[model samples]
Target: MSAGSRVELYAAIRRDARAGMSGRELQRRHGVGWRTVQAALASAWPAQRAPYPPRASKLDPFKPVIDQILVVDLDTPRKQRHTITRIFNRLCAEHGMTDVSYPVVRAYVAQRRPEIRTEHGRTESAAFVPQTHLPGREAEVDFGEISVRLRGELVTLHLFSLRMSYSGKAVHRVSATGGQEAFFEGHVHAFKVLGGVPAGRIRYDNLKAAVAQVIGFSRQRVETDRWVAFRSHFNVDAFYCQPGISGAHEKGGVEGDIGRFRRNHLVPVPEVDSLRELNEFIDDYDRADDDRRIGHRVHTVGEAFAAERQLLKPLPVEPFETGLWMTPRVDRFAQITVRSNRCSVPSRFIGRQVRVLLHASDLAVYDGRTPVASHERLLTKGACRLELDHYLEALIRKPGALPGATALEQARAAGAFTTVHDAWWAAACKAHGDADGTRALVEVLLLHRHTPHEHVIAGITAALRAGALTADAVALEARRAAEPIDSAVPEADGHTAILTPDAAVVASLTHRRLTHLPADTRPPPTVTAYDQLLRQTTS
Candidate 1:
């Protein structure tokens, strides 16, 4: 209604009241409700009306069901949790609640979902008390998943970041896993990088690597035994935040560092040859980040860290072993199983137990205290990392297996079995039958144990060209390839180099011999041995 009309209505009612007209009579004459009559009698202008009481919604009966579903959804994966339509359908089917419309359900769910989340402690409320941090007293640690291309393969690595609560200085490393070993190793890396352990407690979430169980919504935790040992060894005082909020509010420094570092430094998805390379990249960024000023601070991160370093506790003289120690028996195939992944050892180690030092990224097999083999740790279950050199003895005995061996396949993939090796093997197989040729190739492969790999390859190429398909001939050629020209000496046996050296190639050595003897003595170097190829060809 227009204000002028409302004013005229109120004026007529008030003028009647001033002339002693009854309230009921004014209401009847004005054709208005008693509330309007009272309002007009009370004032010449309209006053704001009192709000009406809320009427119950059709969804009221099913709200408890909605709350129960949302409460259960807290334990479910986010994507698999309930939706409004799903809730509405459940209410219709299970509770026989068809009176509630879809719009009503959606509206109630929209209003109640977050409230339910907060009530159940699945979400933190927006308001948080601001905290004052003292230097060297506290730190925060967490792991975040980061994807990078390692040697042209896209691999997801867990990045461990530890940020000083006061200084904003942090250290970051990428590991193959976020398991306990990596967790412990990450702490060691941070402590070493920062030069000491925090004098006060380090804040952490309920990481499975540390906390085996959160004690029912409280700050208490049943920590893993290994984590307890690690903490004691490092002289670390560990403080776990309340389980419900996931410790993010208490440890925002490391939480923010993980995201901020990933955005500013790890963007474009770093491509590196190894985890070592990726970590070096992270280290460079961390050093550069030290100069950054955090949130109106007078001192830069590095400057603050420099002051904080003096307050840190000195590290222990003895270091803790971060790798897991195990003794896995080598199987018949000369392979040992470490956490469901297979790695090969030398054939001699078969049926024997070898000590394994398994780190996050790799595992090393030791015969007693002497390290025998080490392979990069395999992430996928049942995966194998076979080294061909470990199987050479077996391959020499059963040459048939050499062609189809998994070790050979891995060697080929690793470039240890090159095209040159394949070419030489093919040539040998052509000269002899497949079995004998492969046997001879195996013998040639055995030369790699004593001879340089490049020299062995050269020997194979030379023997293939000369049609000397025997392994002995390849060995002779390999020795000749390894010999220096001036120091070349002929073996006084049936075996000799197929090709003789030219005089000009060793003229200095020949001149020295002639000068020591009479002029006619010490005849010049000859290619007469080389001419045996022509004679045999003609015959």
Candidate 2:
């Protein structure tokens, strides 16, 4: 019987005995064993049942043998050490210990193996130096790679992580590359997301974007010129950790944060249409993370951040422009290739050098003081980013080129060339010949330089309904559609110029009167005409 049951029985038996009831009656009432009843009647404290009797283990005789094997393994290479299975096999074959189960031998080895290793002095453990972080004083930065499906294709995205040591708050963003521009852009984005920059210092690994050279065995670094400029621009200082493997421990917080966030939130590969969409998901995940507490800290991360934010350096008046500037010559195709991806420029810029500012997500091509073109940076290799407008003039000369041109294809994909455009082009081709029709379509596309897209579409629809297949007619209707609804007068320059009464009066009043006849003209011929006028007045 259990101790509680025995105790109950004992109390009951004592109570019944005090009442002059016999032990037999007590046993009959409690339905307990006879021995239990006797014990209960004899003693106040109930005795616990004895544990199961000890039996000789099958592994006992082989204990010394297993110990000897483990001792020998200590000297051997770790890879050749004796596993439990090996020990069990040796016990059966060498020791001739038949009928010994593997589990029996395994259990003995497991309990005794650690002791043997300790005797041999092979066990070791790692120790970490405790760290203290002041609020908004220190942060760590790192980049990790994640796979995301963008536009139905799996793409490798570089994730930049910045973690505040005090609050355990972090900011994460995905970039197309780990290039210097992206590195700088990531910092700008992280600072904005955190609402300010760390007041004291930020630590980093020896990323090539930041560190140009590592001097000797020390952590002294020669930072890249652009990186130094960026640091100066932000008015923040940087501390580089020991280079390579040894440095991983210095930024352990961010290292751990990257792994934890990746596992908790991004384990199932994210599906998104663009880097922008993927970052929105990351932003939401970061906001949700503020509710979490770091380890056993009483305050949540957001609460801790609320305190730390006050200690941080106030944000600068303007964000630093995060990009790399280069002068690249436009190729014969009017395209400048960046990182093996082609981006189009104006045809007039071909064979001439232009300024290219390559940002993390986009790039701008400039001619001296004028911006020639801008495009979203292509992440994939050998991909081309072309704007059809850049090639419209050239395509007008080679009308046949518009149908199969790469620029046209890009335009169609970007929705700049819509189904309405296609319908108008086909209608034009039927009304005119193939070459002339393509030229007309190109001219209509050129209207986008001045007309809004919705206005152009409306014009196309209106012209199609009115059976006006001419590009000029289409452009006129598009401009009319774009006119303001509340204006009292229509635009003058768009339609042909006409002499309104106000314009006629202003032109007539502004004409200059001749004071004398020019030497080159017949002099005094005006006097004869005046004499005739006077003669008519006298009559």
Candidate 3:
């Protein structure tokens, strides 16, 4: 009923009429309605009976080419090549046809091509291979390679995906490096997405992510300990397809799914700026895909997953630790390099063995069973740094004897000691010419470990005021005090003064007399000679 079909019908009807064929015969030959043949005949020759309106042609431009290719290739052997692909290639290259897309070209070629004949010239059954699937019983897993632009560089990323066959629900996770970590991460994400694990089994190809070696038809040697732990944790059975033969009908669903997802979602090479942006876009895509119902099913993928939630086993009490474990030798500096980042342990641990846990973004240093320190993963290689503050007490005890003592220098540059304390030490070194001052100041800074900053500042002020400008002097005074106390007490005339009622009364009277007098006030309160003698005697 399309325009191209109508044109072809008109041409066929005119040719048949000139050949003395009836309208019925024309209709049968061209597979058109009788009215369509009549209308074409009437429009071409009008002397006879007029028929109804003509049907339109759907593929007008390529019909003649399709017919010619089919006629010429009929006598050729079927194993030589595909005539359809040849026709399309010729149309685009030699004929310069740009509008003929692959699907449209395929449809035209299929219409003209004769059905395959058996040895006896009889037809054979050509039915589609139906996919074997059960509700909540089957899942397909695969890894797809995709190009993503991250941090101004085009990176080829591997996306591991799992999809339930019946519900068409899917979960996918991406990683820059396709390894055991990415593989397990994908499974974890898929379990989260499906809401529950599938009732039947998980199907996979013999990817290195899942299998170490194929020993037999029913056995596979898996290399990663974490992978074994993962399957054990989830309590789900895993089934791997034959190695290198990824074409089983049961697994073909995920194959087609990869093409569909790549075309519909990852077109133009997915130019995302960051991993987070790519993840958000992927989440939106998953939501949209989950909401769409397959065929006429009443339940969507999301709804189906929700219904199947209770069937899944509970997640392990502790989440799978996605880290690479390795035994690293602690250098003389008591440091280990993980992913090129330097992390330090206690100085006593030098030349000792330790375990390092290297994650995607962090490195955890462990001495025996105890965690010594953790640091952010460094992106670049070379001498990465860890602060000595993390092991300052241990380092201080060893002092110059400690390896990688630059940590101490870094602490000094950050002003870990007071300037006055430093000055007192320098002056003491000049006066007494010894490290006793430095040691004394170090003790003073240590004393402030539990003391408030303000209190330390007041103590330093008191020590300086009390003529303890050198480290030795300050230490002497501090030892004499011993107990923690406020150092901001006011001094008067080389003696500690106390406020009393008689003194308050005298001060108030003096203030009143001074205010009542001129701007340039004179002393108004004079201790009488007798009172002065009594105060001096009391002092």
TM-score per candidate, chains pooled: 0.70, 0.68, 0.46
lDDT of 3 by residue, 336-426 (tens): 7665557777666778888888654356778878987776554446755655544545533543332335765655555554566556656
Q: Which model scores highest in TM-score?
A: 1
Model 2 C-alpha lDDT per residue in residues 7-95, reported as the tens digit of each score: 77688888887899877787788787788777877898987667998799877788899899989988899799888888888788888
Candidate numbers sorted by lDDT from highest down: 1, 2, 3
- For all candidates in order, the CA lDDT equals 0.87, 0.85, 0.67
By TM-score, how accurate is candidate 3?
0.46
In what order do the candidates fall by TM-score, top score first?
1, 2, 3
Backbone clash tally for model 3? Answer: 9
lDDT of 2 at 377: 80
lDDT, candidate 1, at 381: 82
Q: Report model 1's TM-score to 2 decimal places.
A: 0.70
Off by over 4 Å in 2: 1-124, 149-152, 215-217, 242-246, 260-274, 277-285, 314-319, 483-539
- Report lDDT (Cα) of residue 517, candidate 2: 36
Pick out the ten consecutive residues of candidate 1 with the lowest summed lDDT. Answer: 498-507
In terms of lDDT, model 1 sits at: 0.87
